[model samples]
Target: MATSRIRERSPKRDSLDDLELPEDYVPYVPLAKRRAQKYQKLIHKKAGLDFGSNYEDGSGSGYDSNDNYRRKNKDQNDSGRDADEDDDEDKQPLTGPQAGISLIEQSVELRKAQLSAEEQKTDVQKAMEEEAKILAAVAERKQLASAEEISKGIVYKDPIKTTWTPPRHIRAMSEEELAATRLKYHIDADGEDMPPVIKAFRDMKFPKPVLDYLKNKGIKMPTPIQMQGLPVALSGRDMIGIAFTGSGKTLSFTLPLVMRALEEETKMPLAKGEGPIGMIVCPSRELARQTYEGFVGIADMLHKGGFAQLKVLLCMGGINMQEQASVFHGGLHIVVATPGRLQDMLNKKKFNLDLCTYMCMDEADRMLDMGFEEEVRTILSYFKHQRQTILYSATMPKKIQDFARSALVKPVTVNVGRAGAANLDVIQEVEYVKQEAKIVYLLECLQKTPPPVLIFAENKNDVDDIQEYLLLKGVETVAIHGSKTQEEREYAINAFKSYQKDVLVATDVASKGLDFAEIHHVILFDMPKEIEDYVHRIGRTGRSGKTGIATTFINMNSSEQILLDLKHLLKEAKQKVPPVLEALEDPMEKYREMGAAGGCGYCGGLGHRVTECPKLEQQQKTKNSGMSRPSERAGNEM
Candidate 1:
């Protein structure tokens, strides 16, 4: 099929030399390309004008043609040939008129060409200066945006490295000097005792405006934690505070935040939702809102004193995302946020942390407990310098300490009481009862106790059931849990707070950071699984120098170790350990020492409930006969 083309031997005259030009074909010329041939050809046929030795012989400027005659008119296109004629005219300089440029402009150009080493700069240096100017313009715009956001309850961030000078009110001090301050505050650093703590805010060297705010708030003396933490934070050092709830821990961190932000406002540009000088993240919505109120309180005082134009924003769930984000668009300076809401803002690029100099985590231990460590770390990464990261918690477990090692820098720890120990002021009582009897026992507690009782349950279902049962028992009750809408939860909390409800039943959502003022008693229908939670639960009562009671319902189902730990704590706090706790003897020294939940202690069966074990009925029969089995003697001996 391909033979005709391959076998053809006769050739037509179709070579490139014989190919006819197309009627419209034009040679391709590169962009801005000047054809030298066009310039070489003489366009004027009359005469070629000669400009003499201003362009020298063989200097490459004279026109060259088909002939060379040394210094003569060598070009064939020249009107005539004469060697001396062009040169004699060239030796005389030709004075000509120039363009109408001003003398000043000409002088300016001359100076630029002759600039001295000190006056001249490299292109990179010039470019850098121009870039800096552009950045300054951007930062100014951001600062204006942030200030506007602040007026509308939004928190704005600014460029991380503002041109403002760092606050230097804190005198430079060595670790030794700081140690003395720590010792005064009873701060612990790795096994070393800190320096003496300050007795008053004045002694801690707070600015006058802050001192005035404290005085107005009736805080004449600093609490143990505040005495220690404020100094460390003011020094711009990371601080870890392990204190009981209601020990005024909020003030410890908030005071420093306000002061630092006030100082920074004097320095740089800020943007809405961009570079809030202070960021306080909470684990839940209630805490975020509460903390925001606390911050705003202080901010108001400072604002009145002309110390700073401070604004605080509460970022939480169950609210309009646009509303929350819109506040940030105004002029937010301080942000109190839950992990999820803040992380979402960060992901959307609507908020920035470029210039956040202060960061505090309220109930940081609880945040990690709720599985928000990754979010917290992501927030931390947004910070260019975690200048003074502070973590305040009711309990600081080993996990929190490890987290602190990475999250904070050279943190001075202030432990108000024994670390993670329940508050000493709360009188804790434990009762033994089966699950079926819990409602009756709770009723008994209600009958005896006064109003404003806060009873905690393990889950939402328990909270609802208990709340309903209390209502049926002729008790005024309100309930709140994680599942409720934010408005409903607020209504419930407000009802409880205002004494319209005698009792408030809740899940763990109400446990941390929400100050239910003057809660007379905290009853736990179900004990918390973690020791830290138990500490926080009991802390709800016995706050602000007042004593309260915390009673727990215990049964065989409770973790055995937890029971022992509670018992020991009860004794240590000088509270009465009930007979039920004392009568329960340890199963065996072997199990106690080995820390193993060995096979059923009651029936000696490998896999059975204590009540359902088959050996239980036999043991009961033997016990009814009043004759001790040999196996019993062996068991007692073992």
Candidate 2:
């Protein structure tokens, strides 16, 4: 009974084998067995045998025993023959050493054949190698052509011949009259046989079209800078022009560069990829753009006067490099560029300075401040021949002086006023506004000034915040900073310049050589870290002999050293100094009292003496560390 109960088990439970399967179902096979069969088929195929037909029947379960045995025996016979051949090659004659040498030679030949087969390249690979060789040859040829062109010295014309002769009246002026003119304009010119100060643009012997253009712009008399700078620059001398911002410094170099470029073009026309007879290097794109426009305006006038049409190119960051490069194809007469972009173009071999005999570094001090000294030097090296170097800047510090000495050949130094001096036309007002209340106080400051106001902040984030705050308060404002795109910066600048916007919030990017006509007021949202920056920021207004107002906000957060410098600057300009700034103790006051010269002799910073200069220390440290120093304003652009 017990056996029957066990046998009856689970109502005849359905086993896996008893279940019906689909017609296409395949039985499971061990993974190892499947892989072995796969490898066997691959080996058979590689041995020039049909895998499926030689190993199994169509059903894949049966094999011909006789055929398999015959195939195996045939393979074994072939392998045996190869082994015998290898052994015979390795074998040495029992009685002679020559036999061993023959055996070694046979083995070496076998290896050589194997390596040749392994090293064979595909057709596509071979074609690529041939193309590379052709490209290298072409590059070498172009390099040699460039080298030959540079060696010819065709672009290096005589400076004296290229320079325009001054008018009879200017040349005839006596030393007494010239000294009187220099005294009247506060011009301190230092050089051998310095050119007399020009009272009018016509006195410099500029092309009639240039004179007409100046007249049309209502520029009746030359400004202080132009009076001396024009004559010096036109007299075929490398000149260092130190003048305040908006003091006609741009025209001082621009006009001369145009004249030189025009002379070169007229004498020998520029061929494709042949020019940039003149180059003006600026510190910022905005300044470069302004200079380019000024050059274009003069060039247009020249063209209208039946002169050869001058081609000018603006090279700077955030612009289409391809478009800038396109000008080289047609041969541009002049290039107005920032140091960064110009250096980039040179390094990439996009253009050469072979024909650039006229070079100007506008805002040279600012360029140095932005850590462009190396870039400027590298760019200078591209010029194969001597160039008439002109350095114009609002401030000329010792660093710039040293740079000028190395870059220029016996340069003339022309100063309209004290170097690093603030523009006297601006009425500077300083107020203590707490950081938290600056946004609230900014509105009051704007109401005090007219439209076309420029508001500057040291930090780009502060610029954006001020712009957003002004916009929310119903102020028509545009903002520019390093973070903005190039198009945005251009639009902002144009909008402010055209009076389309009542306010412009920006960083130090706009504080350099940008000329915004008729700006009524400039507001500093925060005190600049450097006193030089403060001067340039305020200089944005009070341009072209017009009086304007500058309001600066300071607080406890401001550096005492900068405050002392500001106090001194205000006093030097005869402006009313705030009690807070006047009360700030100069860190180097003791040194000054001990007969040390005021301010840093090296950098023109009033904060510390040359020995205590932080910038100089940093430079020394960087040099000692053998690391390249980064530009402080490298990323700050609009």
Candidate 3:
């Protein structure tokens, strides 16, 4: 059997051929045995490495029994220890030479953060300032552009893309259509004497009530402004009427509003005592009152025609709220108020504007100029957004034009008069004088031809002082200012109207909505702050086809820029500059070169009494760069 000791191969021999079977194989090794095997392997492996037999130095067989264990422990300890040693070496104290670089790096990081923070703050502030200036300039350009458009008579087509040319056959229509057309066009005057716009209204054939109102007002003809405005306003469209003073702008909207009101009243009556169906906001108390009066006069004619009850209530400052509140309680069919008083009443819930269907802002340009824009917004917000809006102004500024654009939805703009339009009836004249000669010249003008003149002063104090001086000089004069009481202001207006006072000394308060029917002259005692204001001030006169005269005081000591502005305005109005003040552009500078003393001789160096140097007076150039210097004078004409 020993001679033939070769193992026999089984069918599965190939699969298990390389397997080694241990004589003491256990299903699972014991913990001690497993650990011993691991140590033995470590000893073998470490002994094979260059670290040498120190890893296996103990016990027998050139391999200490403890050698494998010691070797395994040494390897394990060395792995951990070596890693730790490398970290400690890295963490070892830095050399003195490397410290500066570390500190410098940290400082640079800190400075970067600080610089970033400063830059952020500066950027924010600069952005805010730039935004403000941009807004202001944008506003200016817009106003100038609108004025230019109106001046140039640039008309854009309607958004709805409908053709609006009047029918030629209508002119040859039968009696019924012709009558209807005439009514629509508002043929109030004689046929041959009618303006084309009036003829157009006559051809439209509006309702009877509208025609009746027009006829009653003796508006036998529509003005150019009215022709452009009425058609759109009557169509339930928002509108802006831009025309010079006395171009019948008031009638343009007034006739249309009255017609709409009459139509509504005749067609259907409002719920009893609900509220006003319409409202009109004016810039100043005087203007609001006058507008109310005008509304009342026209409304009276409508009432007699069997129309529904139409009433007007006035709300303004310088009056008792109790009286105003009483009016509100009675309920109004129409309201006219300054923004302040109107806003106050609105907040009290005295009357809800939800019922208001029509609104008009008369003198919208002047309202913004007087800084009533916020108040205007407050009032407009109270009305239903669906209501009709009509904005009327003598001249549209960018701020005003923008406001009108936003406030009015899809408005038809009506521009009246010629390009570079001024109240043609107003004869504008600029007077150049020594600062001292102003009062003397004013007094001379008063003595020669003062016919209920309105004198514009730059300040309220100047208004009062001028009034006093005029009175002391035996001239009948009155003043209106912020300080005046409601009664005093109204009384002053009455006095001016009654011809009791031949001259009125006023600041810009008198610039708007002041309708003194016979104002023959406007005297600019001081130049206005804005070029636009020059237009508003002069608009006070030459109203409704009446001729008027405007005189401005240009001093030698005043700014050349202001004088140039005045010159430009006058030139635009097609008026010639008087020769006396033309060459005195830099009066003060010229006088200074002439060795003038503490006071100017022309304007009294002050803007007052000639006893003082005219050139020494406070200059009236609100904006320093656009006007002439104060006049130099040696005597008081008064």
Candidate 4:
């Protein structure tokens, strides 16, 4: 294990001078020392190129081998030279060209390596971020899917059971629960035990003016609809009352409203031009005007001694705002306004509804159907939440039901007949014909009816054409549509109601509770697009349990869905469908076979001879899975 290594070689080394040490006695050294030794040896080996500055005495005399040898020995002894050190000296520095080449190559290579390393690091980070985002999105989607499933768990069942079942749970209950289940009989049928409220009304005799007005109208006793509705309304109860057109619902709510307004006027006598005492919002302009007339009749009686000049204003769209504002400015004790123009004027700082304690929505369901829901909500939100809200309509559908449920607080539901069903007094008849023959059939029906008739069309253009056709046939007729100005519409409505014109051709705008008392027939010139509308249209006739006729002009190739709806409605009304019309089967089948349902071939569904599709002819594509769609089913099973 003994070894000897020479430190520096001299020109003369005499004989062998061997040196040995034990392998176990070797000592460890730091890496710093080892690296420095390596660098020094590299520099020394090129000493000829490194040592150019240190010359003796500033003379350019290079040292000889002897002097160099002496200098090396002196430095080694002073520095305690180890045996492992190298012995080259006089190394030289690199030349300018070589140094530049080396620097450029080193810099370029270093930059390339650094950039590659940074790019790799960035890529790894981006991949991690993307993976995290994907996982988060997946988690969110799963949560939404689960929430949808949970929400769809709700089930619907009929509240009034058709089939009977016995109760299985007969166990005894706690006394508190048993007491809670007991029914309270607050309503008494005995007229002898009338409530103090009813007694007070009976005791308070009507003024001479009011009695005279009632006597003129020949209204001796209040109808049942009036009896039930008037008491509750006068008591300031929120009520939803439904009665036939002739059931005197107008008087039911109107009487109480007039009484409230009259009493308020007597007690407070609103400032010369202040807010209305009561606001009655009806669905249509004509209806609103009619309601105002009804209010005037009642107010004339109620306001005999106090506030004899009961100012009632009609605010509805189509009428000039300036005219309405003039009336509103003159001081309105009562207002009968359609929702739109009333809200419009109110928005423009026209009138204040804060003083309106009694609010009644006549034909409330129709108001909702005609897209007046948000407007109604906006109007109601302005009043105090505790205001007496009375909603009157001929029918209440699910939409109206939901709206009432939210808008009214613990409202009393009153229906004069069936829910969402029309009057039984109105006769319903359907005439099945080809689509092209519908116009001819309508003319024939008109010819058969000698009395004043109201024809209901589905669209504005149809109303115009029907009116023109009737006029050309020497029939006295007038048309009312939304396109007409308020003045023209008002004039037309007045003409129809006053019998200046025998027939009024109209759209659904005229359908909502416009009581043209003389209208003994309602001819459905075209089937309504929505089944719900049938109720409102037919309801225009058959006012106050009076017998009336409703004729539906159904084409052999009309919508089967509409026919089905008509059949169902007639069945509910307990009217028998004529066997002739009922034998047509699917209405759309004939139209489909003739390829007209696929469209006119030239005009598609536009029903025109032109080859181009008009701007309005483009209808939205519908999903094809239901019976409502006219297209064929995928499985032929339906």
TM-score of each: 0.62, 0.72, 0.60, 0.59
Report the C-alpha lDDT of model 1 over 1-638, residue by residue, as the tens digit.
Answer: 47787657646775777777774343343322222212221221113434322122323343445334334333311433332343443343321121234568878887877786426765544444554454343223112112223245443222122222223433344667766766765656542323344557776656677787778766779877876666666666666788887788888888777767776665653555455778898877767777888887777777777665676777777776666555566456788888777888778776677767778888886675454655676675566443467788987654356546554545567787766667777888888889999987898887656889999987778888998888888889998876677788888888888899899998777788788767879999987755556778888888866788898998877766556556656765788988877765644334435454433333122222233333334435655786544331221111
lDDT of 4 by residue, 1-638 (tens): 12323433324446544434453333333546544544443444345443322122323333343557345434443454342342322122332223324667878988999988768764435444454454343223111111223345422211111111112231233434422322121111111111112212232234566656666776666555665566566656667887765667787677766767666766776775576778888876777778888877766665564545677887876555566455554557888887767777678766787677778888776565444555676676555324667888776643354456544545666555654566777898777667677666777787656668889987788889888888888888988776776677778888887888889888877877777776788998877755546777887777755788888877654555556556656766889876754664643344445444222221112122112223112211231231222211110001
The C-alpha lDDT values of all candidates are 0.65, 0.76, 0.60, 0.59
Candidate 2 C-alpha error for residue 103, in Å: 85
> How much lDDT does candidate 2 score?
0.76
TM-score of 3: 0.60
Which candidate leads the pack in TM-score?
2
Model 1 whole-model lDDT (C-alpha atoms): 0.65
lDDT of 3 by residue, 2-75 (tens): 54454333334566547776643323334454344444444544455432222222332334544474554445
lDDT of 2 at 209: 94
Error of 1 at 295 (Å): 0.8
Report model 1's TM-score to 2 decimal places: 0.62
Tell me the spans in candidate 4 whose CA falls farther than 4 Å from its real position: 1-208, 301-307, 324-331, 580-638
Worst 10 residues of 1 by lDDT: 37-46
Candidate 3: worst 10 consecutive residues by lDDT? 629-638
Instruction: Output the lDDT of residue 49, model 1.
Output: 37
Clashing pairs in 2: none
Expressed as tens digits, the lDDT of each residue in 418-508 for candidate 2 is 8899999999999999989998999899887679899998787888889899999999999998778889989999989998999999988
Q: Please rank every candidate by lDDT, starting with the best.
A: 2, 1, 3, 4
